[model samples]
Target: MTATGSATLHIDAPRQRVRAVLLDALSLPSWNPAFVSLAGPAVVALGTAYRITVRPGLKGTLAYEAMDLDMVRMAWQVPGFAETGDWRLVASGDRTLVHHDFTHAGPIAAVLRQAYEGVAELRLGRLAQVLHS
Candidate 1:
């Protein structure tokens, strides 16, 4: 079984700014608490593996699954989960439209639908704060 979700938000920041924060390993934990820490290159590159520690003492290696520089799109593999996530950025003046899509596969996916949506919304909302802070 698989469950998927998409969340989009217009952030009052340049596309480059939003893109930098979203793709940076060190910057993720500021907005998303699920990521406790990451040990790897600050600039994510294809084929690079980042050792990540999350809340509840879970740890795993994360990698860049796919990236498209020209299209301003990228995806990362989540550790210890049958899940995949991607982000697309579109710039308009000083604002950036951020689209985050997620796909999870597992027997518990149906049960996780509500929680996944809530978390995605929270993550997107917090990205703005991360920019200002």
Candidate 2:
């Protein structure tokens, strides 16, 4: 992995419920503060193209076009930016364990990794809360 980081959060819900929340592409802008909007098909299957606008502080929006899906695991790539290594969903008793691994690509990877790590933590926390609620 190029720029790797992982965070695990225990959600007070079943694995299916947590997965459902994560797979809801349209609801991302509503739940995640960093995401401005998402444009594409509602269902995210393999090879589905999506355009995401990310607000990295006040430096304007960074647009990324990528293909993503969950084949019992999450995988995505933003060409010159980075690729999400693997997003694994593990079942732990009544709770769910969410694991995300990402690898940065190209020159500005290090900086992007740092920025993504911060945003990822926040997003994951929100996901856990949404499932628990």
Candidate 3:
């Protein structure tokens, strides 16, 4: 079975600034500790493929390819499990609303749901700090 989750955070930064951080693959690890490494082009674009590794030690090398991107949204494909994720940013006054949506199949589903339920708030706090920094 596939389990899914969504998380939203409000950052003091502007939407464009938050969106920039979300779109930058190189900066992913700084905010999201689950990411071990993202090997891809220095500049990420739609259709760009990346070799991704995750924490809690997931087995096997996970492959991801950018699916689509817009000014405030980006989606990617996890080809290994046929899963996908999306991030979106919306402007609210001077703040930005950041949202993340994820899906996972099989055992990974339980892991993801557990992670979100356990430390999602803490993770969002870290994400806000990263955006502020």
Candidate 4:
């Protein structure tokens, strides 16, 4: 948790729907950044470690650390980096205010600091597209 970045997205969907999308590990590539593939349980479970390919060659390990109606948190590690990703959901009528934030430690985290904002925007944009579809 040496470096951090966050982005908020308003999706025209209920919190339940938005929460489902966030926990769908197998479908994350459709919106998540640098996420090439997932190799583990199709359904995420707390403490169930899974392997993921950040790119075609780069790999990582991730697990669901916490989950509830309002937020889902994950613990991720790749090479010299370790991170906690939190997707906080706020419900407003028929919409969900998704505040995505991540704190990371290690060299990789520091290196990504300069590009974190752009990356977050890219990911959130893709997510919005998917939810809208």
Candidate 5:
């Protein structure tokens, strides 16, 4: 079975600014605690690949590759995993609404769903702060 989750955050910044921050993979560890580091080629367009190391538990790291970045639509996918998601950016006035939808598969889908939601909220909060500042 698979589980799906979606979250949105309204950022007090222009769509371009929000997208810039989100695509800056190198700066991820600066604001996100779960990300240890990002390795691989530079970010291009959709299908560009990058490696990421994320903390899965107390002392383990889960390595995965991310690809398919639709910069124009502000969307992407984290391939090579049982989960896939897309980030949609909607510009409203001077702010941008970031909508994220993710689906997880496998037996640990429930646990991953909870973890992803919590992580997404935290990341969104951090992104909002950075954009506002």
Candidate 6:
């Protein structure tokens, strides 16, 4: 965890609904362009390791567990990189506010950190659209 970034998104959906979709790793590709596929249990459980393929054939494994209120605290390992992140959901009236914070430290940490910051907003926007729908 050498670099850190955070993004917050507000979705017009119930907190539970948003949390459900977020935890559904199998459905990730339907909403997230970065994800090509995910192989894991129907529901994410603590200590359950999952494999993920992102765009351009990048692959990784993530074993995440819930912290509280459906928040996911995960550590992922890619080919030459590693990162940890936390995804939290909070109710805002009838809607939900999603907060994601991640940190990565590796040989190319600076480059990835900059890239993450640049695309974080767009990624969150896609997530919002999916959550709303």
Instruction: Score each candidate by Cα lDDT.
Output: 0.70, 0.59, 0.61, 0.81, 0.60, 0.75
Worst 10 residues of 6 by lDDT: 114-123
Candidate 4 segments whose C-alpha is farther than 4 A from its true place = none
- Error of model 2, residue 81, in angstroms: 2.1
List clashing residue pairs in candidate 5. 47-68
Q: Please tell me which model should have the higher TM-score, number 2 or number 6.
A: 6
lDDT per residue, candidate 3, 32-133, as tens digits? 777777777776666666676666544333333442333333333342343456656678889977676666665555555565553445555776898777
Query: What is the lDDT ranking, best to worst?
Result: 4, 6, 1, 3, 5, 2
lDDT of 2 at 121: 64
Per-residue accuracy of model 5 over 1-133 as CA lDDT, tens digit each:
6676667888888888877776666676678776666654455445454556655532222222333232232222233235555567788889888876666665556556556656556667888887777
Poorest 10 consecutive residues by lDDT, candidate 4: 115-124
TM-score for each prediction? 0.82, 0.70, 0.73, 0.90, 0.68, 0.84
Model 2 lDDT tens row, 27-133: 86778675666667777665555676655422222222332332233343343454554446778778777765555665556556666665556667888877766
Please report the candidate that would top TM-score against the real structure. 4
For lDDT, candidate 5 versus 6, the one ahead is 6
Q: Show where candidate 6 strays beyond 4 Å.
A: none
Return the top candidate by lDDT.
4
